[model samples]
Target: MNYLAHLFLAKDTPESLIGNLLGDFAKGSVKFLYTEEIRKGIELHRSVDTYTDSHPIFRASKRLIAQPRRKFSGILVDVFYDHFLARHWSEYSDVALEAFSSHVYKILVDNQAILPTSLLQIIPMMKAYDLLASYQEIGGIDNALRRIATRIRWQNNLADGIEDLIANYQQLEADFCAFFPELIDYAQTYCYQADRPLA
Candidate 1:
């Protein structure tokens, strides 16, 4: 899961949404930095990442990546899964994808004071491109992969990850369909702390 999926999995609250998103930058302990609710959201985000990365179905999808880009397989699959989730957004949520995207962007911006600097920097682009909803198109994902490629410090072809996805689109979609539901169940039931349920 990437941004869209992480946000989708978050409980329907501003604090929860911010917390889960902070998972990417709020490394190590969040103890004194954020409110307890936000910290729980970050914890939930970590739990989701651990479960997704270690799942058998996700591992199977990673094997479909071409050898040259094998090292970035995890990144590829994470974005790919987001693509599918966006593509099939209606099945999971009643909210329009665009509406949902706008809502999340507002939440991030309105709560910017508590957000990390790294995330604050991308807000303009995220809304400009409408990135969350854009994942529904392969071209959008391709553009995303290209941008990600440039961000890598090493000389590599993470952009070619799109080809692996295209070549195995059907199988990978099948894998996502199979894996995501199980993940949703796990996330729904997971406790961020021993006492707090996700919702």
Candidate 2:
């Protein structure tokens, strides 16, 4: 799961969204900084990643990536899954994708003061680029991968794996459809048990 899935799994609150997004940025002992609900959101993010990595359906999707790019397969699958989620937004949620994205951006903006320094810097670019909504396009995924590849330490061709995404599109979409519903259900249960109700 990536930003979209993490946010989607989170309880609909500023704290939850912030905490979920923070999962990638913040590490080690940061849970003490947040209220319990936000802390649980961070936990939820980790739980989602664990579930995603272990699930057999997701494992199948990784095999679709070419062997050369297999080292970056999980990264590619994460972004590709977000693309499918954005494309099929209507099936998963009642809210319009544009409206949902707006709400998410607003949460990030409204809670900017408490955000980690890394997220504070990245959130502005996220909102300006409207990266969440742009996941509907292959070009968006390609650009995102290129950006990510540049940031990686190794000189690699993670960006070129976009062709694998295109080649295995339908099979991957099927894999996503099978896996995502289970994730949503699991996340809901996890959050319900772990997070306190919003005021």
- Give all TM-scores, in the order shown: 0.95, 0.94
Off by over 4 Å in 2: 195-199
The 10-residue segment of model 1 with minimum total lDDT is 190-199
Off-target runs (Cα >4 Å) in candidate 1 are 191-199
For candidate 2, the clash count comes to 0
lDDT, candidate 2, 1-199, per-residue tens: 8889898888888888888988888787664688877877788898889999999999999999999999999999999999999999999889998888989999888888788887887787788888899899999899889878988988999989799989999999999999999999988887887344422
lDDT for each residue of candidate 1 in 128-153, tens digit (9 for 90 to 100)? 99999999999999989998898889
Q: Specify the highest-lDDT model's number.
A: 1
Alpha-carbon RMSD of each model: 2.1, 2.6
lDDT agreement of model 2 with the native: 0.88
Q: What lDDT score goes with residue 118 in model 1?
A: 81
Residue 143 shift from truth in candidate 2, angstroms: 1.1
